[model samples]
Target chain A: MNQNKNALLLLTGISLFMAACGTSKTGLITIQEQGSFAVGGKVIASPGTFDPYKPTPAGQTFHGDHAYVFYQIPPKARKYPLVMWHGIGQFSKTWETTPDGREGYQNIFLRRGFGVYVLDQPRRGNAGRSTAAGTINPTPDEQQWFGTFRVGIWPNYFEGVQFARDTATLNQYFRSMVPNVGPIDIGVTTDAAAALFQKIGPGVLVTHSHSGGMGWLTAIKNQNVKGIVAYEPGSGFLFPEGEVPAPIEMAGGQMAAVGVPMSQFMQLTKIPIIIYYGDFIPEKPSDNPGTDGWRARMVMARLWRDAVNRHGGDVTVVHLPEVGLKGNTHFPFSDLNNLQVADLMSKFLKDKKLD
Target chain B: MNQNKNALLLLTGISLFMAACGTSKTGLITIQEQGSFAVGGKVIASPGTFDPYKPTPAGQTFHGDHAYVFYQIPPKARKYPLVMWHGIGQFSKTWETTPDGREGYQNIFLRRGFGVYVLDQPRRGNAGRSTAAGTINPTPDEQQWFGTFRVGIWPNYFEGVQFARDTATLNQYFRSMVPNVGPIDIGVTTDAAAALFQKIGPGVLVTHSHSGGMGWLTAIKNQNVKGIVAYEPGSGFLFPEGEVPAPIEMAGGQMAAVGVPMSQFMQLTKIPIIIYYGDFIPEKPSDNPGTDGWRARMVMARLWRDAVNRHGGDVTVVHLPEVGLKGNTHFPFSDLNNLQVADLMSKFLKDKKLD
Candidate 1:
């Protein structure tokens, strides 16, 4: 309250004062309450070897993944829960709270009348890694995001970039980021997310950025993934150079680095698919400029969508701006417009009858 | 700077310090230079009647609109200047500097290699009204905007809406607002904007909200209007009861006190149109919800786009979120992602070869 008051007092014009009309708490559920509604959380563990770099005295190589899943059960919840998958350099906490310190989408959806489940991928966030298999997984840094997720254009943010400028918001955003362990551990992450989805019963997959690739594989492997909303999935589905029905390869492919047993994109056709890309990216410049970064992701998404559709599957490649949203980063759920995006997702699920 | 430092000091956990790695200035162009460009401004005044409500001793009943236009003259300027039109409750200042204190689109475009022109609509902002036509405009107050602009559902913004919660941002936004004088003298407003376009030479129209109607009308009336980028145009264009090719109606139409005499919709098809809406609108709800506010705006934009396309016109409707932007407010240009959006507009203009 004091902070707000101080800010208000500092405001010189445009009437920073509000009547404190106080937002209505009349919803079926308020975000403040954790008990009245059904809430459950647990660490889904799996066995693995310890760090080879840090040798144990007893040669203790055995370890396990401590990925967490915290869910909020909405009243008369929909048949399928909403499994939210975070992106690279982030985890389930990404959906819990934003940098600006506002309520995350998990609670917003619960209020909007839908059950939501958030996942912490292995080796990220609250999730633990088996060993310091350093070389196997390349930890990502912040600079990569400026170009990849598009927090700003290359060279610098000041040069016409889109990241939030407020010091507070930027801080929150950076703080929320955890060092991302690359797709090298595709199996553990996919298995962890997949297991959570199954354990929670039938559910829809809501994947963001890097998790988008993982989510796709998990959805393919799990029959319970009623539908999929891949929001800016950065994983490029390697298209067969010449043919449409040729061997389709996904970064999160089942046999990818696992030595065996992988999920196939063909099986994904059983469920509805909607891929969302936020504003200004994957844009088609009239000059027919070369595709890369965001444009490439868009290309991959379109190809994957086309492939699925050609195979008699349901897929919708939604360029978000067409639906009316702009100035979003790779992390839309953590954006100021979080609720709006969540509302749209709910609408999509409702449309797919996945609810 | 002090406020920034204070905020940083207050911020806990997150490291707020930066290496000053000032964002890259190596854009297609840089926004920092002032000396290299020639800046000029002029007030275009036109005659009007005095307000009967507030009598003046000078018998100055005959008044005029002091519409101002600021032009940034860039070397090797593009074939067409970029004319920016502001929405209701705003003026040419809308393009000058956003509420968030960052540079607005005008500068962004100017830096992106385009001559930019902005207009102060008649009876709004710096453009003053002559007579108190008492109820001519009904001069809508703050409450009307809350629901109308989707700032929050009626009654109050305190409710669960998508408005930025921070007072500072809100203050800047509200401070930036100009009390709308309604569309009482839309002809004069459109004429003012149109005349400026002619004086400035050929240019693409970038209209926001209320100005969208004016931009459309001006484009139709002026041969110089090459194309249009209508961002979140909320004004509904009432299609003739049953006629497809009938004269269309626009909010910026002449003598629209209570009924018709509006322009035809077919004229709009002559030029390229791209309508953009920010996130969480034009949504298809599970509840089979009624349309109003942003939803209505979406319907209007779509109707206008479809009607134009039906007439063989080039048109595109962009829902920002689908393109990767989220958490945007009605005033996206004023939101945290303004530059991102400005960049997109610049890209569009570049693609159109307007710049």
Candidate 2:
């Protein structure tokens, strides 16, 4: 009986260990709340008597030009949520699960006890209703995007690209790209972002690619933006009105800095900002439009960085390859090594005392 | 020492119990696979020399008219995955978490060990690029949708409506509506859905509102459709060419049953099918267009049921009010009592042995 009791105890101990291990691995996320809402849309009323029973007459009103925000707050969340805004032709899905089924930044940040707010900018993705009309030409633009996104030329991966190279992953990646329902209006998008900041109140703004430029303007428009973490702001670098940098000529087009008032530009200087760029961007100008475009952007980024630092603002630009984290594509956050990249971000947050 | 050992063993046993309980409550979901892909889009190449280095000239090719599908499969999933397609002005968001933040049918069915495939039909939502050009006029049509959706007239909820009445919920609901980036082409949408079935293999097709008609056509188009569970198929009731019913007139316009060949119509008879209609749909046609429109639809649905039954098909139509489940809006799957609605679906699946 004594031996049997000892064996039972040992079994219980083993069971407890396994149970605890399993719980940690598969523990349910205790969510404080998760919901979605819209911001910055207007109602355009038409000149006719609206009737539900009949076909909508020419005078019916329209409610559009809005941005949509989906948010999830975990229990014991940090002080501020990370507001994730996607780039051109993308939606909140960019921050959700990656095309390869890996955890995206939304889940990654949520696991680290920070609330996450993913946005669909006006006239894009879920916010498809627009006040302005634009033609969505069924144009074969995947290869164009592939080159632009630095995923490498079609049919070939850049030697050390961090993106998943499997056919399934590639299929999903291409499928994720969506077209804008209306014309791309930077002002409307910026207004929506500012409105989101106003509604959510005091949050870190995270922007990718095309939205990077809008992020700067949003910070200037709203004081609620505590900080900004941008990944490859492809365009829309702003400077105080007479200080705009000379345009960097690219194979596609000329990349120029937009000029904002000195006061609005100074609002960006009030916040700590960090920028991240992935691999394959050459130090010098190259004939390959894909790499060269980014090279120009990086050069502009440094100029912007210097300008901010000169004004007593904190700014840091990280080239992943230079930091020993190589082979990252434009989308470093969704790359396979995203967890490592996230750690780098966490360190920055800690150093800046934002966490 | 023996006393201490007994105490330790008891503590271990208690700890094991707690861990097991915690795991059951909050265990992390082990996903077998999750990814997305597009199906059935034609590539329309413009007539010109394509140049990557220059502006997209007139000759650039466009990939449009495709449906985008996001799928998540759980380990040990049921035999057939649930293919969820949304209705007018909506996307896969309809099946995701609801406006009120409740687990939508996607997660609900996923938790029940069923793989879920959420689709964005061609020219709509995520699949916004289209071959045909259409206008998205910014229209204030939320009131029209509210009435048509049976949530009640503007600013008024049907007494005991199943929809969440909070302003936040209302805001989210209105924001969820997306305009078609191009024309609303049912043929194109049906073709894409058929292609999705062909790609994914045998699965149960679940559709809501507008897609309900397309679901029936999809079943006829592809043999991979194992079953169908539709919620409020507002239009596109199919009948044998010779037996097409006269169009039902409504305050809005006329509701018509599309005609298909008898051979194609017979395909629906091969699968087990079920339909659910929510509350506020009156039994008799009334002057109130909102209720009357649905009353006409319900009447048409019964006629459809008779037609299917006449041809030896398995079809069941459940009016929630008649079955003691009351106060449901058009979207019963995302209602406050969605779990109950899910239970009814589960029962049907069991009866049909599709699970």
Docking class of 1: incorrect
Model 1, CA-based lDDT: 0.55
Candidate 2 docking classification: acceptable
Give lDDT tens digits, candidate 1, residues B1-355: 9998888777632321111111122212211111110011122222333222222222221233324443444444568877787887665556755544455676566655577776656544334321222112112233334434556533335233335566544434443443332234666677767777666678898888878777777776787889899888766353333432333232223212112233555566777778888764645422212113466557556666676676688888888888887767677775668877777776777676766
By summed lDDT, the worst window of 10 consecutive residues in model 2 chain B runs over B21-30
Name the top DockQ candidate.
2
lDDT tens digits, residue span B5-55, model 2 = 999999999766544332122333334555456788776766766555553
Q: Distance from true position, residue A43, model 2, in Å? A: 2.2
